[model samples]
Target: MRTAYRVETVRAAESALMARLPEGTLMNRAAAGLAAACAELLRPGLGRRTVARVVLLVGGGDNGGDALFAGARLARRGIGVNALLLAPDRAHPAGLAALRAAGGRGLAVADIAPGALTTLLGRASMVVDGITGIGGRGGLRPVAAELAERVTASGAPVIAVDLPSGVDADTGEVRGPVLPATLTVTFGTLKPGLLVDPARQHAGDVRLVDIGLRPLLPVEPDVAALTPAEVAALLPRPTGESDKYRRGVLGVAAGSARYPGAAVLTVGGALRGGVGAVRYAGPAHAAVIARHPETLVSPGTPAEAGRVQAWVAGPGLGDHPEAERVVNEVLAADVPLLLDADALRGLDPARVRARSAPTLLTPHAGEAAALLGVARERVESSRLTSVRELAERFGATVLLKGSTTLVADPAGPVLVNETGTPWLATAGSGDVLSGLAGGLLAAGLAARDAGAVAAHLHGLAGHAAPMPATASGVTDALPTAWQSLTG
Candidate 1:
C-alpha cells in the first residue's frame, strides 16, 4: 500500500530525523537525488555536461536550499546552472555560497527584465521549481508567479522540488496561479497533495527521494491506497469442503419497471463477483432471467426473499411504496447492507445512523450533498473531508464515487482508489459497483474492505474492456479483474 501524510506530520518527522543527523547530511542526500532526477529528464541530444542548462527558481527556505545545493552538484559536472533568487535577502547563505563556488550563476528574480527572463527560460533544457516549501501557505509571490509564467510559456519540462508551489500540502487545493511540473521529486515521504486531486493534477509524475526519515514518521498515515497483493490476501477463496451456503449468498433489491435493465446489470456484477449464489428480488424478473438464468428470483419483496448473508438495496429503484418497503426491510435486517442510487432518497439519516448492522452507503456527489445538506460543489472541493463527514454522520462506511473513488469509515485511514479512467463515467456503473461490493460483503469482508476492493476491481475491469467500455462491459470484465489479483 502507498501511504500519504499531512504537512504537519511530515514536518514533525523531518525535525526528529534532522536532530540526529550531521548538519549537512540530509540536505546533501536530497540534493544528490534531485540532481540525478533532473539529469534523467534531459533527453538524447542535450548533454548534461555540455549543452543542458537547469534553471532553479530559488526561494527563502529549505526548499530553496535543496535547489541551490542541487544546482551546485550539476555545476560541478559542467552543466550550465542558474539560480534565480525570488528573495535574495532571505536566501540560505550556505546554499548560495556552495552554488557560486561550483560555477553556478545567481541572480535576483526582481532584477531580471521580462525580455531577459523569457529569453533565458526559453533556452533552458529544464526548470526546477523551489519557490515554496511545505510550510508556506497560499500562492506564490508575484515575482515568483511571473517567473513561473515565463517557464510555462517556454514549454520546458519542469522538475518541482518537494511539491508544486501554490498547492495546499495538506488539502491538495490550488487556489491561485502555480507552476505545474512535468515531474516532482519529493523528499522523505509522499505528501497528501501529491496523491489527492486538484493539486494531484498539477503534479504530473512524482518520485520520492529517500532522505532517510521513514523511521521517524508516525505509525498511522492520513490516507492510503491498497496494493494488489494486500487485496489478494483479503479476498476469500472457497475450499473443497465448503458448500454453496458456506461460500455465501448475496440478496439484491433493485430496479423497477421504469428501469429493468438496472436489475440485469446488478445481477451480472454479483454473479461474476466472489459469491456462491445471488437471490434477486425486484420488479424486473423477466429482464433478470433473460440476462442471468441462475439467479434465484423472489415473487415478493426482499422481506420474503428468504435467507441472505448480506443485502444490496437501491439502484434504479423508483420512488414508490414497495421500494420504500424493500429498503426498510433490508435496513432492519441484522445482515450487512449496501445502500445506493434511489435507495438513498428513501433513507432517513437518523434511521441509517441507528442501524446496528454493517451498512455501506455508496453515493455520487449529488446524493452525498443532499444527505449532508451541503452543495455538491463543497463536497467536490474537499473530497477527503466530505467523505469522512459522511461516514461519521451516518456511522457507516461511505464510498464517494468520482474520478478518485474514496472509501472512508469512522476510523482508520481513508482508502483512495487510484484506478479507473474517465470512460468509467458511464450510465449504470454505480449499480454494478453496488452489487459487486455487496457480494464481497456477503463473502465475509467488512464494509470498508468491500467498498475499497469493489471500487479497485470495478476500475480495473473498466480498463480491461475495450476502449469506450460501457457499464455492461465493466460487468463482463469482473472475472478478469479478480484473476489479476489471484493469479
Candidate 2:
C-alpha cells in the first residue's frame, strides 16, 4: 500500500529528523533525489552526454532552497541550470551561492523580457516548480501564478521540487491557479494533496524521497493507495474442506418492473465476483435468470432470501413502497448489508443508527446529498468531509463514488481509490460495483475492506476490459478481473 500523511504530520516528522541530523542534511537528501529524477528524464534515449537546459521557478521559502540546491547538482553534472527568482531579495543566500559555485546562472523574474520566459521554458527539457509548499495560503501569488501559466502553456514537462504549488497539502484542495506537473518528487512523506483529488489530478506522478524520517513518523496514514498484491492478500480464498455454506452465500435484493436490468447487472456483478453462491429475491427474478443462469432465483422477499452471510439491496426498485419495505426488513436481519441506488431514498438516519450488523452505504453525489439534507454541489465540493459525515451520521461504512472514490468508516481510516478510467462512468456500472462489494462482504471481509477491495477490483476490471467497455462489457469483464486476482 502507498501511504500518505497530512502536511502537519510530515512537518512534525521532518522536525524530529532534522533535530537528530546535522544542519542542511535533509535539504541535501531532498536535492539529491530531485536532481537524480531530473537526470533520468533528460536522458531518455541514446546520444552523447552533453549539457541539458533546466529552469527553476524560485520562490521565497525553503522550497526555493530545495530547487536552488538541486540546480547546483545538475550544473555540476554538465547541465545548464538557470534560476528565475520570483522573490530575488528573499532567495536562499546559501543555496544561491552553491548554484553559482557550480556554474549556474540566476535571473530575476524582472530581468526576463516580455514573452522571453515562455520562450525559454519552451526550449528547456524540464521545469522545476518550487513556488509553494506547506506554508502556502489560498493560491499562487500574482507574479508566481502568471509565471506558472506561461510555463504550463509552453507544454514542457514539469518536475515539482516538493508538493505542487497552489495545492493544499493537508486537504488536497486546489483553490486557485496551479501548475500541473508530469512528476512530483516529494520529500519525507507523501502529502494528503498528492493522494486526494483536484490536487491529486494535478500531481501527475508522485515519487516519495525519504529524508531519514521514517522512524519518527506515526503509523496512522491520512490516505492510502492499495496495490494489486496488497489487495490480493486481503481476499478470501476457499480451503479444500470448505463447502458452499462455509464459503458464504450472498443474498441480492434488487431490481423492479421499472428497471429489471438493474437486477440483472447486480447479479451479474455478484456471480462474477468471488462469492460461493448467489440467491436473488425481488420482482426481477426472470431477468436475473436470463442474464445469469447460475443465479438461484427465488420467489421471496429479501428477508426470506434464505440464510445469507451478507445482503445487498437498493439498486433500481425506484421509490416504490415495497422497495422501502425490503430495505426496512433487511436492516432488521442478522447479516451485513450494502445499500445503494433507490434504497437510499427516504432513509431515516435514526433507523440506520439502530442497525446491529455492519452496514455499508454506497451513494453517488446526488444520493449522498439527499441523505445529508444538503445540496449536491456541497457534497461534491468537499467529498472527504461529506463521506465522513455520512459514515458518522448513518453509523455505517460510506463509499462516495466519483473521480476519486472515497470509502470511510466511522471507526477506521478513510480510503480513496483513484484507479478507474472515465469510461467506467457508464450506466449499470454502479450496480456491478454494489454486487462486487456485497460479494466481498459475504466472503467475510470487514465492511470497510469489502467496499475498498470491491472498488479496486471494479476499477481494474474496467481498465482490463476492451477500450471503452459499455455497462454490459464491464459486467462481462468481472470474471477476468476476479481470475487475475485469484491467480
Q: For candidate 1, lDDT tens digit of each residue in 318-383?
A: 887798888888999989999999899846878888888899999998999998899998887777
TM-score per prediction, in order, is 0.96, 0.96
Off by over 4 Å in 2: 44-51
In Å, residue 208's CA in model 1 sits off its true spot by 1.2
Candidate 2 lDDT: 0.86
- Could you tell me which 10 consecutive residues in candidate 1 have the lowest summed lDDT? 41-50
Model 1: per-residue Cα lDDT at residue 460:
89
What is each predicted model's overall lDDT from 0 to 1?
A: 0.88, 0.86
The positional error of residue 275 in candidate 2, measured at the CA in angstroms, is: 2.0
Question: Backbone collision count in every prediction?
Answer: 0, 0
